[model samples]
Target: MKNIAILTLGLRHNYGGILQAAALYNFLKREGYNPVLLRKYPVQKGWKAIIIKALEILPFQNLKGFRNSYIKYINNIQFFDEYMPNQTKIMTYKSQIEEFLNKYEIDAIVVGSDQVWRYTYINDTEYDTYFLNFKLNREIKKISYAASFGIDTWEAPSENLNIKKYLSDFNAVSVRESSGQEICKKDFGKYDVELVLDPTLLIDQSFYLDMIKNKSPKNYDCITYILDENTEKKELVKKINVECQHKSVFNLLTKSSKLSVQDWVASFKSTDFIITDSFHGMVFSIIFNKDFLVIINKDRGADRFYSLCKILGLESRLVTPDSVAIDRMAPIDYSKVNEILDQLRVKSKQFLINSILE
Candidate 1:
């Protein structure tokens, strides 16, 4: 089996990040390849080592400083272990990716299913890492699966030429958003990029339900997952619970989430409805087939939601905080939505097959 190295954004407390990585890794393993998740950041040294020492007293594993919160962190770490079975022990960031790949003897590298290609999110110095711009000792297949620009429009960086050069080396490229296809051709001159589903959607909902089957998730009439919460959102959710008689409600925040990864997936199981400004929150709501409304998190990028809704024929679900009319909204017609997804899966899986095989 080929040793496939999967690269994406850092795998931390974010539910979407972990799930996407797991989905791709698991999908590849099922396809009969040895897949490994690669976390950026190798063993720290120099100034980074000093910063680590300074933050050591705060919390690493034990309940020394933040006793009440440290245990929750440990649970999250355990969640990481459960989802990612085959991952590198130590991570290497930026240009060091070349050495890390060599050390592992990776046969191929797969970049993304997240905002990995969103130029603004990447650092100026390390753009090479995400773009796969490295001088390797041996030639290995480099590809991107559902890599996203995060937004609809393109804003070329100063090093556009370098990006084009890097992509020229890629064996295959697929993007999460259709807009990325235009950006690739218009801005980067990479004309052959294919639009595909996010890695999370590559797997079926039963798999997620099975992971949380026995976790005993709490039932909520409405679950709110707002990444950038404000008074407007708080008041809206409060009114929603009061007006709709949603007695059991919960706020799922990854930053302060105490739930395990499996537990997090379980939280979606019992919720009748979902209110979120996050892309993945919207995704899970659809996966669970729950009635939902989305408040676009503009800062995070709204194009992803638009692209998804357009694909699933659920564009009406997208609503703004000010323009929301709860009474006027209608239930999503998932029968048609599911039909579209089922057909898209075939095309997407074919893209992967062609990309991986010669």
Candidate 2:
């Protein structure tokens, strides 16, 4: 079997990131490839390491409180084990990556879908503004799978020349959205930049359906609100709630102070409609065949939603940040979105399978 290394950002928790990675891995497996995950850093080790990382994650928790809360959170989730690297004894980040790679028997490396290529996502530096430019021996097939820069738009300088040069190392390259594709083309020139489905879109809806339990409470009509760290989203969600007065609105941040990626997906699926600013919010809405609105956040990265909507012929749902009147938007025809989804799913599966065979 072909051993493929899957590299991504935030495998431990971020719902959109994890789901996209999961979908890609699942699709790669379906196409007859053994996918191995390779994270940027190693999982924390020992009580001290765990405590340090937990403290790092928590915004305002004392060391003991963070540790206890983290352990409890870890125990409750099923996918936590698979999400993070198994670093029971390992101490360093470099050692962890090497150990994981050696144990998993990775033959090829596939980096991306999330912000795997962006240095800005990891650190704050001039280099961080560019793509990762670590020196590597070019022997194995290097592929990028729908990787994103995570910025709404960017224009790097001469200092980031190496970052643009690094793209040449990859055998194949794909980005999550059209804006990403444009950036790649503009910066690196045309080098096989294709728009692949997000990892969440790579898997079928049935997989998620089988995993979630106790799905909706009674015949209650629910609406999901997936927002970024944008204040405009709060206003739009309020408008949507007012428009859909009869039904209850479930804003993810408000409903659960602590929520998992799977929990978000489950909640989104249980809803009759999903209303939000998050790209994956719109993604799950499409996957579960729910009517949704993409509240465009111009400051944040909302192009992914608009790109997917355009691809799937759900153009009507794309609402600008200035669109205060939620009631003015037209109701979506989910059946048409399904038709586009079915065709894209087939094409996306074939693209990967065909590439592997070649």
Give the per-residue Cα lDDT of candidate 1 at 109: 92
Native RMSD of candidate 1 (Å): 3.3
TM-score of each: 0.89, 0.80
Candidate 1 has which clashing residue pairs, if any? 41-91, 41-92, 41-93, 42-91, 42-92
Model 1, position 304, has a per-residue lDDT of 93
Please estimate how well model 1 matches the true structure, expressed as its whole-model Cα lDDT: 0.79
Q: Which stretches of candidate 1 lie over 4 Å from their true place?
A: 42-74, 254-256
Best by lDDT: 1
List, in order, the clash count of every candidate structure.
5, 5
Ten residues in a row with the worst lDDT in model 1?
Answer: 61-70
Candidate 1 to truth, TM: 0.89
Q: How many clashing pairs does model 1 include?
A: 5
Residues 1-358 of candidate 1: C-alpha lDDT, one tens digit per residue: 8889888876655778778888888788878989888777323468966755455445544333343244544566666677667777655555467777877778889999899988777534465788788778888899999999898876566777888899999999999988899888888899999888888888888779778878887787888888888887777766666766778888887455567778777887788888899998888888888888788788888999999899898888787767555553567888998899888888888898778787
For candidate 2, the 10 contiguous residues with the lowest summed lDDT are: 124-133
